[model samples]
Target: MDILDKLKNREEIYYPIERNRNTDLRFTLYDAFLAKKRFERFAPLFMEAFEEINGPCYYKSDLYKSKLGADVYLKLDSELKVAHSVKARGGFNEVMVKVEDVLKENGMLDKFDELSLNDIRKIMAAYTIEVSSTGNLGLSIGLCAKAFGFKAKVHMSRDAKDWKKKLLREVGAEVIEYDSDYTYAVKMGRLSAEQNHMSYFVDDEMSEKLFLGYAASIFEVAEQVASSGLIPSDDEPLHVFLPCGVGGAPGGIAFALRSFFKDSVRIYFVEPTEYPCMLYSFVHGEAASVNDIGLGGKTIADGLACSAPSKLVFPIVDSLIDGFFSFNDESILRAKKDIEEIDEKVVEASSAAALLAYEKINRPKNSILWITGSNVDK
Candidate 1:
């Protein structure tokens, strides 16, 4: 069967023909280095803004070799402080960087440490942070913005969970619900921010700052891996499976990994069967909706239910990602259950995609399953 037929059938694997590690990328290693510095520089503000965030954003790695019968390590971004998801990395940093920019522009940067919380609040109350999300990203942005005393507006798609919307509102964020899908929510949210000079839209599909926030997390991961005595080399390369949404989170990490490992690491993305937007974008060489392939883009993994790949992240994903996998709702749920049984930890469906993808791939000795988040109310 051809690729289209296979997609319709919900087949597991698709490797793009144009994946080249040596491809010339517009965003260089120096850019990622600067992004890392920016993330680190904002650590003090992140801690001050969110009481739940005590220290630097770092992940724990547990070797689950025996239970899963592989040499795979579980990289638990799910245990991330604050938002309890990988979105906390990008979403929170996006707001923090923007806040810093505002402070610098107003000549308040040097006085940041001397300013009281109420003083910071007075300054931030004039601006608003806006974002569109199916669930996790909105929660991250809303929680961070409210904590920093900035008004937040989250444009939520139809697939967003009711609990997520409720949580945003409880934290003082204005939640705007749309009956349409993620793409439409993004369109409306961007338009709304454009009309308001005081509002800043955290564009998941095109924000380099958001991408950099995600990319900076890789530095922590590398340090953890080296401590565990598993180094990525030509003979024993690392295999990483990440759950992909609109592509910013996974694409950013993949870009940074390629830069660091230089073909010594293989990165794969897993998406819901009908909503494989990144995969579709990689194949077509441009950003397009999954609707073009006759799929409605519905799934149990709501966080991965985007209809189109990110235009900003696609080129990076295309050049760096080694393979793509798609799984249906049943498989995702099954994987969730199986992981709970094996590790005694219940993950959300979106985070379970990495497990399912890891099982299907020909994994190397140093394989890592990147668990994005856990908001499942078990």
Candidate 2:
């Protein structure tokens, strides 16, 4: 009912990471391997758009490690290229791959390849793509869709920030605002795309490309950690705290990390107390949504205002993540203010969720928190 009450109600859940999984539905090392290859294919597109993608963009963000009394490092998705958020990774990959899929199916692969960038624009302009989002994903999809000359439509819920909506419009996407939640926006986007043959829908709840794009971060994180000479052994385990909305970003990364580190890594997802959808879903063992409990989906962290866990990522989340925690709006603001004063870094509300989780863990030697986004309004 209240902030701390939500934390008190948390049902702790985790699964052991191993080489083989008995269940057909649960994710395994093979899935991580396949996801890596998918990411490699799209990583080039990311580089083409913004000089660099997976490797050069991620770095350590400044945080008050001593104040938290843990050796905490931040994976700076806040400074990532494109839309300055983790969403860009997934959104870009989904749009690019979808365009290619349509081209290949139409028997235009050779024709599409022969065209120059400007010439390709003419070929791409005839198609359309749509996606539903709270905010950041729309920015990524809209910007990427526009780049490839698609008539883009972004369906947004009331929870989306005004600046994000305006940004999508400025980038040539048809911005449709709904007086509803994310699920409703996504439903409408799906319907609209289904009505037209040339239209493609990037379903955030089920897009494997989006999941693969997020999983790609694992390679870079592993490389960066290895280069820094910090080995997370069984004695001193590695802890990573991440912000969760629809669960794709954290779930994908968790799947990869679990495969890479085996039992040495622990992944935790943090969320707005009112909208801890994934925690409820994992604990309930089926599907769950905030709306089922009469939540209107209000939160300061707009990017994390999803009312439900994504169906595609929920199974992987249940299989991979080590923990989940929720906090109130005030907690997000307090952490943002305190960390800004202490660390001299300005992070958005969703980005500060990792810091909230950091305080809750008794991590050993190595720990990394993901600063997933910073698309605050000016």
Candidate 3:
């Protein structure tokens, strides 16, 4: 059968392609450097806003020397303090960027460092932060919004977990449930935000702020990996397997890695078989959805149940990404189980996609499987 037919059958597949790496000039190393500096400037604000975070969200990488039998490490973002997911990196960064803009407009930017949490919250209360998500991003946005006293409205797709919705509500966000899929929720959320003057929408599909936030984290990733003595070279390439959703997080990461490591790293995105939107979009040379190909677009990996890849992200990372790995829910469940058994930690199905990719791919001397989030239910 053809690749499309194979994808339709929900079969496990790895499609590798030569990427031109230098094709996109819209985002550059300078952009990443600027984002890194911006993140550093917001460190104090993040700590003051979310006391639980303590400091900037730190990535925890554990080397599994015996388990994988190779130089493999799990970059566990699931253990992050604030939102307990990789989404917190992007979500919190975007919110802080917006907050910074507001503070500057009000002549409080100079005084921002001296302002108390309540002082900033009083200003933030005049605005609303909005977004649509399958789960994790919504939770991140809601938590960040309420922490800064901004009203939050999360448009949730039907596939979003009940626990995520409950957590969002508990954080004082208005959760609007949609009977349809992620695309529809985004459309509604965008429209609603456009109609309001005091609303800021964290567009998962198109927000450069969110993309930059994810991209900036790669600086920490590179530092952590280098500290562990696994530097990527010509013969010893670093293989990074990232879990994909609408392509924002993974795409940002892949772009930054390509800029940093150049040809020394092989970046792969892992997606649900039923919703391999990024893979399909990459192969077909256009923006398309799983629904366009008659797939159900539903999966146990709710965070990865996106119908279409992000239009903004896909084009930027199209030349940087090396390949795509698509797997069924059975494989995700099995990977999750294996991870919990081996690491004694529970991860969400979406996060387990990277682990499955590492297992399916050829054994590399150095590989990093980025665990995106924890299963809050567990």
Best by lDDT: 3
lDDT string for model 1 (1-378, tens) is 777777766666655344675667667667766767766766676677666655675322243442664677877777777777788778877887877888898899898768766777788999999999999999888988888789999999998989888988998899999998999999999999999999999999999888877877767777777887887887778988889989989988888888888778888899998798888776666888888887645789988999998888886676787888888899999988887788877678898888887778655578888888664563
Give the TM-score (vs. native) of candidate 3: 0.95
Candidate 2 versus the native: TM-score?
Answer: 0.86
Output the lDDT of residue 310, model 3.
93
Q: Provide backbone clash counts, one per model.
A: 0, 0, 0
Per-candidate TM-score against the hidden true structure:
0.93, 0.86, 0.95
lDDT of 1: 0.81
Which residue runs does candidate 2 get wrong by more than 4 Å? 1-70, 106-115, 375-377
Task: List candidate 1 segments past 4 Å from native.
Answer: 16-18, 57-66, 375-378
Tell me how far the alpha carbon of residue 359 in candidate 1 is from the true structure, in angstroms, after superposition.
Answer: 1.4
Q: Candidate 2: deviation at residue 120, Å?
A: 2.3
Candidates' C-alpha lDDT: 0.81, 0.73, 0.83
CA RMSD, predictions in order: 2.1, 4.1, 1.8
Give Cα distance to truth, residue 331, candidate 2, Å: 0.9
